[model samples]
Target: METISIRAPSTPSSATKARRSARTRLPAAIALLPTALVVLVVYIGCMLWTVRLSFTSSTLLPKLDWFGLTQYMRLFANDRFVTSAENIVIFGVLFISGCLIIGFLMAVFIDQNVRGEGLFRTVFLYPYSMSFVVTGVAWQWFLNPGLGLQKLVRDMGFESFTFDWLVNQRMAIYTIVIAGLWHGSGLTMAIMLAGLRGVDKDLWKAAKVDGIPTWRVYTSVVLPLLRPMVVTATVLLATGVVKLYDLVVAMTLGGPGIATEVPAKFVMDHLFERNNIGLGTAAATIMLITVVIVLAPWVYARYVRPQGRHA
Candidate 1:
């Protein structure tokens, strides 16, 4: 005898699952709608508004009239702005490198499972918890020639112990770099320490079995594995470098004759103190562009490239 075979329908189950999933997700979608609207209206809207103002002839107020690239031309021609750009470049290089080097060393030290590990971690990370304003103020006092290190050294019978970089026109920016390193390295150390802890014990044992030097193992094998942490620290430090205002304000006020002036300070001075809104917005726009340029590559590699591969 021949038997007829039949398959149960699948469409109704698939339709039911789709409807159930939609019902489950509807509340979450509704919850996120307001936040999405605020981001669009507040953050993106303000960015567009700022960019628009950069192309105007506004001074002491915002004007909607078109003014071409006149503000940019004036900005580039200004000697103070030129110096500010140079100072920021110098500060950015020294500050980022110094923090990374010092932070890595500190992380290595803490990774040895030293006694009082918690206490050391707390001490190392404590500076990062303080605001930049406080760090700047404290360092300024400590670095002040007459009131801080110079005075103490001089009082101790070394009258020629000149450590007055804080007030010297040529060396003033390095003082800001020093303060930045102190405030930022702690955070980097914490990041690197976490990365170090995640390293496999088997790798260390393998290196030991191979008679490899500890330093060689770290530089050759371990450093590459910590690239993500290094990138994270770099991004955080770079953002700090870009928005560097309150620190300079508290520490130098952009003086020893504008020697320590940064792009952020330049924008503030033009927008508020100097009342050149057009030029200020142009400076701000340049900064925004710079940040976008720096981040685009990382974003593409991190998010976009992975998705492309999956696709």
Candidate 2:
């Protein structure tokens, strides 16, 4: 046989391409280093410290003296904490569901290409521009029995009109829900509207050709396709619900005998107002654990599963 020497094709281009890509990304990575460091030091570090302190008997100030689950025991046993947990559940469910429903409807209505679309879009989104503190205060005034809706209605010659939910222990939490919905629905609407706008017009045309009713098309076709948007909205709303402090403070101040108290407020009271750092840290840790428990599965399903499949 004739002597033949055939070398494999060179992959220098691939190597060179990777090198160039790395070189290009170097600047962006460098730029992000400061932010990454800050997040690690401030957020993660503080979280770890808080968790550690939760195991201690710190009061008035942080101390490393271990105390096991004493604080947690007291936390669960406390009526105020129990009420706060319950109130948070109610607020979260109603606030999230209300925002989703109202936001989706608003988005659908806007998608109809009605006249003054800009005006309507702005009107819907304007509330989200205001700070939560402002929204809470404004809604508080509006919900006040003596000065707000009840007063206005009563002044209109209706002696029987009474809308004192803001001060009613049984209904105070629902008032928080109303304010939460108003403050949050606008953002959800904007997000859903963006998703709606991005959808292919061909889908609508096909649905129309099939003689599908609008509501059925939405429920079956359009809404399903907006799952990503829905997920995004849900996450945002859930975060708002979890870290719900400012709104409650500004609106109800956990009034009506702690009817509207929430976990965050509980933590705040323990940490600052009550000078129980141990309890505060324990409450914070509990909230953290609760969030992780609730979100871990969804997060794994949404992100980890896909990446795992690729791996």
Candidate 3:
């Protein structure tokens, strides 16, 4: 056979170099300028200012008077601060897990070729669409004993029914949690549904041929494949947990004597209401440290490290 040799087309190195030089001068720099400006103007700016204030005896006006670690010491000793830390841990664990489990179940049920698919999706996602201000009030009313659950149950002739968690000091925090779950699970469901839709349809067909129980296919096979989405959902939930304030404020008012008090609420109360900037910054610093400690490893594995084989 007559030999035929085809030369691979190649661009000149000068052209390649010019393109690379252009990337550095224009598109890449344009892409990065906003991010760099944002980091400086917002993220790093707040972080430095916060840390600086933490070391100061600043009050309402954020004065520049230095006062070592007195605020940190006071923060460590404050019973409310201690309790807030404990509550955050409890809330973080319960809220993240509850949202994921319930959200996953809801997503699965909704994905089952159900009736009123759009209506059901809208109903589930409406919480995400609506502001927490309204949702918190609605949940508060629903949880209130005299106005809502207890009264309704009593009216239905179960006179002894007492769902009074909303008022009880010890039980009220969980009420915030319940409302938090209700408000957040919708977002979680949406994320998981997107994940499910992206899953290979062939997996289901293979599972059927092998007679694998659907639940087993999910728990054993599918769930493992969904690590990325779960991580994304958890991070979203975790950040919300760290910034948990409005829900506590609107629903409970951090009331029943600060029983449902959260760190973010504590920060806001000090920073704006109580005029205690140093203490507020201390709390914020602690929260920031906590988030870093808990999240740094996962973030490194997910984003920083070499991508591991999914299977």
Off by over 4 Å in 1: 1-20
Pick by lDDT: 1 or 2, better one: 2
Give all candidate RMSDs, comma-separated. 7.8, 7.3, 7.2
Clash pairs detected, candidate 3: none
**Candidate 3 overall lDDT versus native:** 0.85
Candidate 3 — which residues are off by over 4 angstroms?
1-27, 307-311
Sorted by lDDT (best first), the order is 2, 1, 3
Residue-wise C-alpha lDDT for candidate 1, range 161-182, written one tens digit per residue: 9999999999999999999998
RMSD (Cα, Å) of model 3? 7.2
| Number of the predicted model whose lDDT against the real structure is largest | 2
- Model 2's alpha-carbon lDDT is 0.91
Worst 10 residues of 2 by lDDT: 1-10
The CA lDDT of each predicted structure is 0.89, 0.91, 0.85
The candidate 3 region of ten consecutive residues with least summed lDDT is 1-10
